[model samples]
Target: MSVTALYTDLSGYYDLMCADIDYREQSNYVRRLHELFGNQGKNVLDLACGTGPHLRHFIDFGYTASGVDINQPMLDIAQLRCPEAQFTQQDMSDLNMDAQMDLISCFLYSIHYNQSIATLTDCIASVHRALKPGGLFCFNAVDKSTIDNRAGIKRQLTHDQSNFSFQSNWYYSGEGEQQQLQLSIERTTNGITEHWRDQHAMVALTFAHLQQLLEPYFEVHILAHDYERIAPWENAAGNAFFVAIKH
Candidate 1:
C-alpha cells in the first residue's frame, strides 16, 4: 500500500498509463514465437508483470501462468484481474522460482528495470537458471545508442470522468551503461488537476553487448520489434525483440 510514485503507490493508475497498448497482439506474437522456437510447454513466468495484463491473456490462451513483480499493490490488482493465476512479490533481477518455467517474459522494456548492467546480467542468469532446457526468454529492448533525447511519446485519455495525459521518453547521455525513462502524468477532473513525474533508471546497452551477455547461456535471436510480424532485426531500428533459448 506504500506505492508512492509511478509503479509504486500509484499502481491503481497503472492501467490508465498503458491503455494504448495492444496486449492481445503482444501476447499472440510471443505465443507464436514460442511455437516456433521453444520446448513446447505451457508453463510461463512473467517478470515485472505489472497489473498482469499479459498474464490475463496467457491464462486465457491455456498456459499455466505465474507472475512476479516488486510492487505488491500492482500484484494485488493483477490477482484480481487474473484470479486463476499465481502472483508473487519479488525483484526480477534476482529471481527465484519454485519450478522451472517453459517460458520467461519481460514486456514493455521492463527488463531494463534491472537498472544497471551488472544487475541485468544477474537477471539474465536468473532467467536462464529458472527455465527448463530449450525454454525461451522473450523481451523487447531499446538500443541506448539510438535513443533520441528529444523524442517522446505522449497521449491523452478520458476514463471514469477523469482526463489523463501521459508522456514518456528515453534519455541517454551518449555514453556509459545508464539511461533513464522519464515519465510525466497529469490528471484532471471537474476543475481539479494533479501532476506526477518519475525518472526510472535503466540499464543501457547495445544489442551486440546484450547478445554477448546471453550467448553463454542461450541461443539468442534478435527480431524486429513488431507484434504483427516475426522477422530478423534489421540493425537499423532502435527497438527489437530478444528471443533466447536456454541451452
Candidate 2:
C-alpha cells in the first residue's frame, strides 16, 4: 500500500498497536523537562502527533496544544481526542506555522520518520524556526551503530473478540545512513487469522552525527532514554532523549 493508505489503514489500530506504551509517564516526564528547559510558555506543538495521546495529557497539564501529522485520518481521531487543540495535516520535515511555540516534542522515536538525513536536517531547521527563543525541542532517538538486528519485541492482546499479535524490530545493514523499522501484526477472529507487515524507511546516524545536526539551531543535551529520570546519556548507550533549546 501507498504511504497515505498505509497510515490511514492502520490509524484505527494504532492506539491498540501501542497499548504497551506508557503515554502518561512520557507526557509527564516531558512536562518536567519543559519546566526545567522550556520558556515556561503554555503554547506547545507535537510533531507526528499520532492520535494525540500526548496532546491529551499536555492539555490536561494546562498547555495550549497544537499538533501536526501527515495523515488526516490520524488527525481526525486526534480532533475527537483533543477538541480544544488545533491540528494540521503537513509533513514535519517541511513544517510551517504562523504561531510560535514554547515547547515542541516528537516522541516514541517518531523523529525517524523523516526518511533521510537531508530531510532530517530540514526538520531540525523547521523546528528551530517554529520555536520561540529559549523554547525546547525534545525527542528520543537511537544510534544506528547500536541496533541489534537479532532482537525484537512481541506482544499480544485481545479486543473485540479478536486476538492481536504485534511484533517490531529495528534493522541496520552495518553501513550507510539508512535503517528500517520492520513491523508485523496478526489478527485472529473466530479461528480465521490475517497477517500484515510493513518495513518503514528511516534515516540512520550516530549520536555524534545527530548532535552535530542539532548544534547549529539549539543547545543540545543527550540524556539517557529513561522517561522517569533526568540523567546524562552514557557514551555506550544506543538510545537517548535529546533536549534542544532554540538558539
Candidate 3:
C-alpha cells in the first residue's frame, strides 16, 4: 500500500498537530513499564516510530534504541531527530531483524494500521519471534467500545502559524468483523487551505478477542488509562496498554 498524504504530505505537520502530547511523560511511562516488565538488557525496538520522538527520550533514558517505519519521509525526519539510533523501512506485519531485542514498543495506536486480524496476529507473532526469551512487547490500543463511544468526534489544534482540525467517524462493515474509520483533515496556513479525506479499516477485535490471540505467544498483562497495571475488566471501556512477555 502506498503512503497516504496524512503520513507523507502531512508528515512534517504531525508533531505540530499533536503538539499537546507530552512525549517526555509518555516516554517516562513507557520506560517505567519496561523497568517493571522488561528484561535486564536495554536493547529496544520501536515499531511505527513516527518522527522518533519516543526513541529520542528512550535514548536519553539510557537504552540502545532503533526505529522502524514504513514511510521513508517520516523516517527521514526521525533520522534527523534521533541521529544516534538506527532506522529501517519495513511493514510491521513482516518485521525482520538481525538481532533480537529486549523490549519492543508500538505506541500511538499505530497497530490499527494492520487493518485485519490476520495481519495484526502476524505483527504480534513477528514481534514474538524478534524478541529474546522473556522479552517484553508493549503497546496501546483502543477497543471497540471506546471507538464506538468516540465515533463522530471532532478535534482541533491551532498553532501560531497554522490551524488544524480532524473529524473522525467509525462504522462496522462486512458482518461486524471489520471496522472502518473515516478521517477528515483540514489545515489552514498562511491563507492557504488544504483538505484531505482518509479511510482506515481495522479488524474489530474486542478485549476478550485480543487476550485470546496473545495467549498462545505471550503472557498478557493489561493496563488502564493512566498506564498503571490493572485487570482487563477494570477499565473495559477505555484505551488499554498491554505488556505481553514472550514465553
Candidate 4:
C-alpha cells in the first residue's frame, strides 16, 4: 500500500485491530522492569506509545509517565484515554525531552517500523541520549519465528460487532523481509468496504546483532523467554526482549 493508504487504513481500524492485546499483561511487564531498578528513579518516557495503554500502569504506580507517538489519531485517542498523563504527537527519533527519564519503553515490535538500518541505529542512539545515566531502556523485536511459522493463507475473524471485523490473506517473501497482505474490511452498519493491499518491509535482527549495537552504550541482558529475567540458552527459543541499562 502507498504510505497514504497505509496510514488511512490503520487509522480506520486501529482500535478494533488491536483490541485483543492484553494490556494488563503488557503493563505488568513494564512495571516489573521498573521494579528491577529498586530505588533508582521514578520517571518514564514511553516512545511510540500507541493508545497509551501501558502508561496507565506507570501512573497508577506513582511514577510520572509521558507518551509520544507519530500518528496523530492514535495520539488523540491516547490523550483521551489517558487524560491524566501527558501525550505528545512526535516521531520517536526526533524526540527532545528536556527532562531525562529513569525508564524508556518502546514495546510491541514498534522499533521495526524504522525502514532502514541507519534509522534504527539512530533510534537507539536517541534513546541513549534521552535516558539518564544508569537508566533502563527496553524494547522488543519480532522473532524470526514470526516469519518461519507464518501461515494462514486466508483468514477471517468476526468480532461480535459486525462493523468491526478483520479479514486478511498473507504470504511472505522467502527472505522474510517483504510481506504481501490483502486486507478487506467491512463496516456492516455503514456497508463501507475498505480494501487495501499492503507490502511491508521488516528486518529481523538476531541477539548477536542487537548485542553488538547496544554494548557500547549499555550493559544489556537478553530476555529470551520469561518477562522478569533473562534465562540461559535453554529457553532462548523464539521471542526476546532486550533490557539495557545506559552506561
- TM-scores, in order shown? 0.97, 0.97, 0.89, 0.81
- Backbone steric clashes in candidate 4, count: 0
Question: Least accurate stretch of 10 residues (summed lDDT) in model 1?
Answer: 1-10
- Kindly list the per-residue Cα lDDT of model 2 for residues 6-125, writing each as its tens digit: 368867888988888999999999999999988879998999998999999999999999999988999999999999999999999998898899999999898999988999999999
The residue pairs found clashing in candidate 1 are 3-8, 3-9, 4-9
TM-score of 3: 0.89
Once superposed on the true structure, which residue ranges of model 4 sit more than 4 Å away at CA?
A: 1-12, 37-39, 144-146, 152-161, 167-186, 190-192, 225-236
Residue 105 deviation, candidate 2, in Å?
A: 0.1
Please state the error at residue 160 of candidate 2 in Å.
0.6
| CA deviation > 4 Å runs, candidate 1 | 1-4
Instruction: Give the alpha-carbon lDDT of every model.
Output: 0.92, 0.92, 0.82, 0.68
Q: Relative to the unseen true structure, what is the C-alpha lDDT of residue 164 in candidate 4, on a scale of 0 to 100?
A: 48
Q: What is the C-alpha RMSD, rounded to one decimal, of candidate 2? A: 1.3
Residue 2, candidate 4: alpha-carbon lDDT:
23
* Candidate 1 vs candidate 3, TM-score winner: 1
Ranking of models by TM-score: 2, 1, 3, 4
lDDT of 3 by residue, 114-136 (tens): 87899999998999999999999
Model 1's alpha-carbon lDDT is: 0.92
Error of 2 at 18 (Å): 1.1
Clash totals in order: 3, 0, 0, 0
